[model samples]
Target: MLQIDLWKRVLIWALVVAGLVLASPNLFYSRVEQHNDAVKAIEASGATPEREAQAAAWPSWMPSNLVNLGLDLRGGAHLLAEVKVADVYKARMDALWPDLRDVLRPERETVGTVRLQPSQPGELRVRISNPEGMTRALELVRGLAQPVVSLTGAGTSDIEVAGQGSDIVVTLSEAEQRATDERTMQQSLEIIRRRIDEVGTREPTIQRQGTDRILIQVPGVGSAAELKDIIGTTAQLTFQPVVSRTSDAETSAGVGNEVLPSLDEQGTYYVLETAPVVTGEELVDAQPSFDQNGRPAVSFRFNPSGARKFGDYTAANIGNPFAIVLDEEVISAPVIQSHIAGGSGIITGNFTVEEATNLAVLLRAGALPAGMDFLEERTIGPELGQDSIEAGKLATGVAFALVLAFMFFTYGLFGVFANVALILNIGLMFGMLSLIGATLTLPGIAGIVLTVGMAVDANVLIFERIREELKTARGPARAIELGYEKALSAIVDANLTTIITAVILYVMGSGPVRGFAITLGLGIVTSVFTAIWVTRLMIVIWFERRRPRTIEV
Candidate 1:
């Protein structure tokens, strides 16, 4: 035995073995993660044909692969949903004008046929529709306290109400218009958030940018095609005028009311009421279930006010077929079905569980404003990801093999000792990534490859120092002792700079950059122990077991 400290060797081995123990959980957890599914299963419908039809429908609930796969490797969809701020602003302008007109209608008319219309700078144009009445109303309105400032237009002497000058404007100023746009973006994001939550996918990110766009990322979501369909749909519910059977036969197929309850007259569908009775905002909850006859149906409950409104409408309509149109397509139109006084009702149709589920999802998600057209869509497939993993492993193995060969040939026995430490360090990195749930991406693999070469540098420093120490004619014990002590300062100084760079990268990076940073950071710490400490301890054990007369580099 080369009379070296056994305690130091034992401590070094303890760190390595403890790392293995700590990392073991990641291996076991990864197995479970691999087997997890991403799709949800719907309960079977009793209709054999319907159930058979649904047999091909994959479950929406995915139970595994929580970490996001990169776009190149995984085939998934990507979409950029533009909020259409200008369109929203226009709609808001149209909707708010009526309310303002009504609020000031009495005064404007009281002043004898005054006209009120939208103008610049919260401006409104008010002229005498009835000159005699307008004169009386204006005197009262001018005296009444309000935030409005009145002006006369250039071409005509019409009174202009504006925050700025004589422009006919509504209550909404430039700031308010911007605020409305901002609110639309926020509300749209909320709606998107709710929809994604219902999807039950893992690691999905939905972020808002500026005043008009939303970015969504779903890690393991396979059906990005369907995801865009779900997100792009505004889901707006309207109370439109409906034409009955026999009235518009040419416009629609007057099928069995069972097949098409919402057809117009003459076996055609009715023109839906252009003015909505109530929006979809009142819907509280929805679920897919079987009716008493075991047929697929969507059961929905409304808010108290919606329930009362629905009841009133049904009670008045009697046997009229009322339509439930979502995004302009009639989903269901049951004949006033015996007065749904409870504010809850069922939509019965020839629907499968999957069909009913999608409806439930849309209803639960509420509707979007206007017609939200899709701007962009991208779908990713998982086959590519698996192939990338294989390729990454190949490249990593090649680099590691090269490192192993170089180390074994370069320093001879001491190099062999460092190579073993390098292998353990890689294992330790893997185990920790698994344990901590760090996703391994292509860039992360690159970091691992780079670390393999880096780990060798520490060994080289120690081995070269040991060779220089031998010139002093010291014993093997003293030579190794001086070598570790001398290499410590340089090793720490070099790796500290790396760790600092890694910290900066992590702070400034996003997604894959962060993944690379994490791998690099973990590598640096493990390399310090394995390269500096592990090698020294292993060499000591070698000396103790077979104490050689002269240590060869």
Candidate 2:
């Protein structure tokens, strides 16, 4: 005979899981101010083209919303970016053919004109007048010696322009195609992350899923329409127009910073200026750090050329403040007190460590190649989120009560035992959510409710089978034994199917769908233990103590 204490053991296990789930979220990132309002969630960047923009990702405490609410159910921006494979191929050709032309110094007498075209595998085609010059060009290309940093491939087939007449087209070698794919995918992701940072996406999550596909999720974004405006903008960048501050009077290089005045996008007057310093193009990496007194700062390393330029510039203007301008807001304006000879330096500002570190990640990723297109944007008011959460709780409570009542009325003592286990199952799921630190969306609450309603199905299967065994005129002990044994196969099959389905959903889906799948998956495992072991132990204990010779439903 099973002991009543056995059910208690399973119940206790359930409690431990519940406790863990409830304590997870607060364990990560520390915060300065709590979020009280979503409408005023973040400081407004004032207004733009009749629309106001707010930081939608997370609080200043966390650089990423890696654990925050996703779009759909919480609502935010969605964007799709397609890397320019064609432009990549074009750049390869442009860089290659020029060098190949220089190499093919086919005696000017042998060839009049050499033309280039595209081919498969991202190779370029080069053609020269006079078929005989092809041999010379090919030979020159074969023997060509120089570093082709971004462009690759050598020899006749690599420079494959074998058509008729004076023009030829070159195709990319397989190696070149492979290299470009990697560069574009990596660069595109970094560029998107940078633009999001520049525009102040608090904790935006940008990841690459496939070769050319990137997935971006920004939480608390209030304007999806604005995101559509930003996401598609090519945003290409380069180091151009390097001029001294004295070159333009209107551009102004004011000395002695007694609050230098500047203009905002609206052409309004504002005091800003620490004079012009070098742009961010030459930066290699940046990280968030703390100073000697533990104040927030940003540290950065530069490329060799940039280091030389920086050392020279600081040596020349030791007392002048150099502005660290980003997205047109002067982030910092520190005086160049001495040479940064080691090619690395730090940016100190009125910043929290998180904010400073995020800025470094942005700078390391480099400026966007072009101005952004806000493909999507939106925000969730905290009031609404809180209200919805409360409503979900009420709904879950009602569902649980209804399920408990139905099960108890139908199955009697065993049903009561299932009810107790179900409560613990609920607690376990919540505790795990807290422990795992998953963001709870409205759909996630629905998942919990659905689990509550469906979790008892397994218990019902076992109980009903027990009833069937008793109808065969079996003794109480024999009935309960056969009941659980006979039903185990069907129980296993059903739950396995449910688990597989959840796995497929989680694997293929994103955002809320994924959240729903996780909750459902966890529910299945918890339900099996409660239904099979906890409920059975209670039933057996009751039978043993009461000594009921005949079973009662």
Candidate 3:
């Protein structure tokens, strides 16, 4: 009999209604977006009257989830940046120098006086006064080497040590270099993501391109330069012992020391030890606040490890000046008044309120492991995005109208049923996208238009089968039942193949390609549900109410 179970019928209608309700907010996209933003702001900070009104623009009980727009649709900043992975090598070698000096100090009778010598980048050279103790120096430095912490680098040490005349040269091994490059790239991606998320942008794409390059696409940013400014700041904060303050920029910083100009004082340079007491990586929290003199400053709190190091350094070096360095420039050189405990400190500089807040944001987000050189940069204007949206709307409307007209005229009453189901299917597809928070691009719109055409295939097959069934002298009810049963295999087979293809595309592709795959995959699921179940239920209801003796297909 051409009848659906009562529970099944009710479930079908419930799903249809739910999908349409979930998709209804997209009809007033801008208003719902503003309401969603207002709600988020109210949660983050207390709501004002204007924000309250915006939040009230939409009903509270309704679903507020929206399909996020992609970079193409929303307009954004695009950048291809090459990371300077070699920069980390220099820092690694500099940090190794202090450890090497400490280890060789015990052997001063044999190794004589161990002194840091100027060397090329990525190499640490230590010169000993006595050449006869070269074997002892090499043995001690090589003893400090540890096995690389990687599967491919198993059995290889992190550093390679060799004797060159009276100097011992230490450099990172090849396996360790590869590991460091991978770590540097991963850290850069994370820091860039955090920095962009701090600004509250939607669905920004931050991904690694090659071995040492990153691709960043941020939607709703004003320009590429603005996006760069937000993420490009290295914000590498370190506290080091200040050797001396000098006005001569060309003055030699001496071995194991570097010269950095002061941020607040022009023409003032400070020579500081290359090794830091504590780095920004140890910081747990940073916030903008006022100092004792009521000036804008950034207050920072460190983790336990950082706190211990900072406290020990300050306690042992009372009255000695320590340089606070940011991105290789000395921000402040302040004398330690006493043992500053608890690992909390303030960085006071010549900064406006906005600068202090931005600095705090960068500090909280953490520093990039390596510097980035912008290889390609582009800014897409919102006006262009609006034009693209309008074009997509026109194409979708035309395709929908054409499909609806063709379906209605070709199969008469059955075609009208298919048309109604098609509408519901479109709504269901959007509902799924919103629920999943999928990003919609221009290619995604094309997938929707394509779906409108493919959605009526099942109904057409069923209608043709019924036409043949009616010729074989079957009763109207039996013909309709057999028609649906026969068409079910074909519909499932066709949609199943398409869904598999969509899955493959999604897995192998990226960015806009994945957007298209998402829409296509979701469309097939909704189309199959509407074609096989919703249309059948509607036809069953009509036949029951009419009690027609015969039906024309």
Candidate 4:
């Protein structure tokens, strides 16, 4: 039992060497991080002399990845936002109006004139001038309904069309609403992720909460307000045909049209078509650039389909003006000077360079389908984070020292070997974490502390069993062999159960709790390897070299 095979010895030492190598970079985290950042900046922009020197500070062959600090540890902002899913329902209904009108206009003589009427939220109400043709009108509307593809609502239609008296009430069905909510939440999550990723924040958590809410945690952001400023705006950009331009705020554009106030110019209102000619969804790319007058502006290009439609519209209405609306506010109403065939255009307004850059970023990330209601927002200060980190280090050091002292007092030299293996176990855990780029939260520190105690249990079990065997009159080597063999099942059972719990926590938990689970789970694996392989290897080497007649534990 003491002698290991040649390959097994090689494999164990190789793993130890790899762990140490991977874990070494964390000792100089700030320097490596700065070097990595400088390298990325150089790659993004041109490699200037200063940036080249900064990049040269760390060698190219050295590992640059560090264990990412969580939002709680790094100090950042946390936001819980609830998506306005019902808003999509109204939009769906509004979008349906044009198609419905186009389909029913030809049947007007038979089905009567279909006039839009006020109804409940998420419902499209149409009043029929002729009451007798209600059934036919209902049939026509029902024909436009599509099948809902949701797993839970496979057999249902997308919308429920019903007629009461002289009106038809069109509402999104149970299936469609569920599908819409899922789609909206997915889009919201993606957009939020893109927005955060665009800013290059480290290890941001953008995840969905429940059915309609999203939880966002961004490290290194100044405040909740600052984070909100980056991604809070819906940035709903639309190009709507201009109906009229006026200075009167009270000027109503009548039915099928709406008036919006100018964003930059005071008292200027623009009456525009309710339906957009092109939306931000059609945008393929957007960048901050300069206008003809050298003013800050955003240039955007649309996809092929959008470009074709835009080109056709511009070609037909060269002298007419169109309003560029952002989040329902009119940015500008510019005349179509020529046929814009390439699907690219510049948006000019009273904008600073920063404003133009941010707008471009928003446009590139795509528009949110619905608005978000921020339910909770908070900022964690860097000072508090530093305090937490310092306290955690102190606690870990104290725990490690106490454990080593106790092990040495009880088992002498063997306890020293166990302590060495324990330290390596922690090193291996951190190496795994750095390799995987896992975030270390405050709870994750607690996990490592818990692991320090757990890591020594297997060694204690084997040592106690060896003591028991010695008391029973067994030879020293035989006692040691039986001790490790007998303790194997018990150690495996204990670690396996703990690992199962950690897995459950990781799967079911969120944010900091999940971070704790990750560290705890990795700690278990590393501790098991150190106990079974590393500690055994150390004992084998000692026994082989000494050939002691009698040994103390």
Candidate 5:
């Protein structure tokens, strides 16, 4: 009556062994982490002698996954950045000019000459020589409006067109602005994540905070400034037709052109077309390499659409200067000698090898849609992290020892069974965390310590029930059977409620709070399993072998 099936016993033991094996990697966290990093490097680039040696530091067959340490535990850079979302509004308006010009130019006979009139940052104002044709001009410009591709913006156009005297004013609709903001935030998060990931940092948290702000936490980075340099560079590479090269910064760029200072030569500027032939967004790959003269450079390849555009621009503009612009600065302006059919090209600048590599990384990660103003930045040192880790270890060890002592002193042999299960429960929780690549923070450690005390609750319930049954003169076997049976519902009900609470916390929380919730939730599940199954099995095996007529719980 108090027996488990053969298969069930085997399955339970197998799971326990497997969990302990998975968690064993954490015991040698530093060595395993080094091995993992070396393995990743060897996979990314061919294995070198140093990397190979590091990779062999840990056994190949052993589990290598470790619980990722959070920013607070590992210590690194934290930044709160407010994105300049209004920057995209100006860019949008500037881009609309070309489309508006192309559309209105076809109807020149009716609308007369069109001129761009600069207004506010977000508005594009176009003036026609013939004011009477304003209706036709507005209609033609409004034709360029597309339906906003968002659920909340259904049936609404992206641009709102209005007439103001002889000018046709165009601005983004409210729906489109909301959609753009969402897209900008998402893209910023992704690009920042990619940039940090490229640097091989562990578990960097890049997430949107509010409407136009981002919170970036990178672990293992040198400093806040270093982290900023990695993700904050706009890296907005563009190839534009050069209107003229000038030494004076005050040179007028005229309509549809922009003047940018040169990066390599001070006091030199290039007036370039407002619209680029190809942007960094179109780049499929970028790598650090050398130019013809063996100087540090970035070699880049374009996607198919970009390749076609670049090839067409090069063929049509042979002998004309093409400006390579990066973040409103001209990196180079070279005269095109012949048609460049392929989409591959080299970007040579006054760059060191490090600069070239950084540029390549940035280009591969893609440009930020808007600039960020860092509102808060802090650099946490490894010494602080080590202190936190030591404190956590002390707290956890104290909690574990106290729990083990209380259970052993009160419940005797049965308490020893609960203590073993409790230890295994911790191992199982860590195994789950390592398997899922969960990040453990200071709060998560607190959660695990809390779990240590809670893990013995089911055992106490069963032991108390057995004490009650023994007083009723039931045999040891029947008393044990009734004890487990009576405690089952209570154990499930209590742990289930706690698990639900953890789930809610995880859903509502962010960062460290989520880390806490993860550990709490997982600990509850593992605790329930060990309490209901592992401790019971141990007691059953002991009772079967000894055949005790009367047992002390």
Candidate 6:
């Protein structure tokens, strides 16, 4: 144990140096955070003189990533929302009408005048004038169904078709509903993430709860209302062919067309084709811009596929008006004066600059799959967060001091070695947490305190074992070797068991629970490393330098 290899000594010291270097930033948290924010600002906008000066304040080689503080520590908004998954069913049925009608059009004689009828939600009811053709109509509709892709639903088709006398009802099958729900949840999650990220806030936790619920926690936001405002707009933009223009409120809209009130015009309404020529999903970018009329407008550019489709439709219907609709309201109906091939257009609306900017943000984020009903909302104040931080700091300092004192008094000079290792162990823990960008919560402080107490356990075991070996006929170096060798198994078993428990907690829990697991797991690892390697290295170095015939450990 006294004769350590050159390579091993270098590696161990290198790790200690790296830990201290990485953990140094947190000691001066405010300055580093400011430097990081300034660098980001400079990167976003071309470096101004002020920003360049600010960036120079912090060294380039220093690590900029900090341990992100959780909502419980930083204070923010928490919201629980339920996605209206059922709304998609009604939309699916509406969209299927055009295809269903076209498929049965050729068989009008056989199907006997197919007509849509009032039905329950999620069910499409089509009445046949003659009951004799019900079977053939059902067959035609069923032909449109596609096979479900999921493992549990591999054999079933996407739609279920049934016929009763003269009427046929079509509804989404179990497999299709499951697939649709998954898609809706994913879309909702993505859109929410985009909306939040656009605002340039710190790490936000957005996760799915049960089947239909979502939990959102955003740090640094003032209120839940602010968060809601950013993501509330549906912003479903679509370009549809205008079927007709009308001033009468009660004007009849024919089959496969919808009548929507004009957004700007006082009393005008437009009947537009149900099928969209292009959707917001095709948009690649959107920005707030001024139109030719010097009014607030949003400029948008479409992707390659959308450009091709838009160009073809515009070329075919020159001089015909097309309606630009947003959220089921017609924003404008402008005639195609000429072919628009570039897939870039301007939307002129009665909007303020702020409104235009918000619209651009929403359009860039894409539309939500379905509406969300806010089930619960909470605003955590900064005062509470400050109090929690103070409490955590006090608790950590007290625990650290007590652990230091206990180790020093218990093992004499050897106890001082353990205390040094204990301090380094904490530095390494913070270094790891900072490196991984883990969030720190209130419970995480408790985990660190528990780690401080547990870190000395291995050192205590080794020292007591050494004392026991000394009572027998053994020299200092051999007793030291046996002590470490015997304690190795216990240290490995204890730390591994704690780490496994932490992993389980993290996998099964969320939010604050995850924060505790992360700190606890990292603490266990750093503690074991410090107690086994660091303390042992100190003992070996001392033994070699002193070369004492009789030593008191």
Every model's Cα RMSD, please?
Answer: 8.6, 10.5, 1.6, 2.6, 1.8, 2.9
Which segments of candidate 4 are over 4 A away from where they belong? 45-54, 111-120, 127-133, 163-168, 289-296, 337-342, 350-353, 469-478
Regions of candidate 2 where Cα sits further than 4 Å from its true position: 3-68, 80-182, 190-215, 222-284, 287-299, 303-341, 345-361, 365-372, 378-398, 472-474, 540-551
- Count backbone overlaps in model 3: 0
Q: Tens-digit lDDT track for model 3 on 1-553?
A: 8889999999999999999888888888989999988988898557999999999999999998888888888999999999999999999999898899999999999999999998899999999999999999999999999999888899999999999999999999999999999999999999999999887888899889989999999988999999999988989999999999999999999988889999889999999998998999999999999999999999999999999999999999999999999998899898999999999999999889989988999999999988889999999999888888999999989999988899888888988999999999999999999888899999999998888888888888889998889999889999999999998899899999999999999999998889999999999999999998999999999999999998877
| Tens-place lDDT digits, model 2, residues 327-413 | 544344556677668678776667876577556656766754333323333455555666776798799999999999999999887
CA-lDDT, candidates in order:
0.66, 0.62, 0.92, 0.90, 0.92, 0.89
Which of 1 and 2 is the better model by TM-score?
A: 1
Q: Give the TM-score of each candidate.
A: 0.68, 0.60, 0.97, 0.92, 0.96, 0.90
**Number of the top candidate by lDDT?**
3
Task: Write out the backbone clash pairs for model 3.
Answer: none
Encode model 5's per-residue lDDT on 90-165: one tens digit a residue.
8889878878999999899889999988679888888999988888998899999999989999999999999988
List the lowest-lDDT window of 10 residues for candidate 1.
254-263
C-alpha lDDT of residue 197 in model 3:
86
By TM-score, the better pick of 5 and 6 is 5
Q: After aligning candidate 2 to the native by TM-score, how far in Å is the CA of 421 from where it should be?
A: 1.7
In model 3, where do residues sit more than 4 Å from their true spots?
Answer: none
The residue-by-residue lDDT of candidate 1 on 386-466, one tens digit each, is: 788789889889989999999888889888898899989987777666556676677887888889889888888888998
lDDT at residue 511 of model 2 (Cα atoms): 68
**What TM-score, to 2 decimals, does candidate 5 have?**
0.96
Q: Which structure among the candidates has the greatest TM-score?
A: 3
Q: Is candidate 1 or candidate 6 better by TM-score?
A: 6
lDDT of 5: 0.92
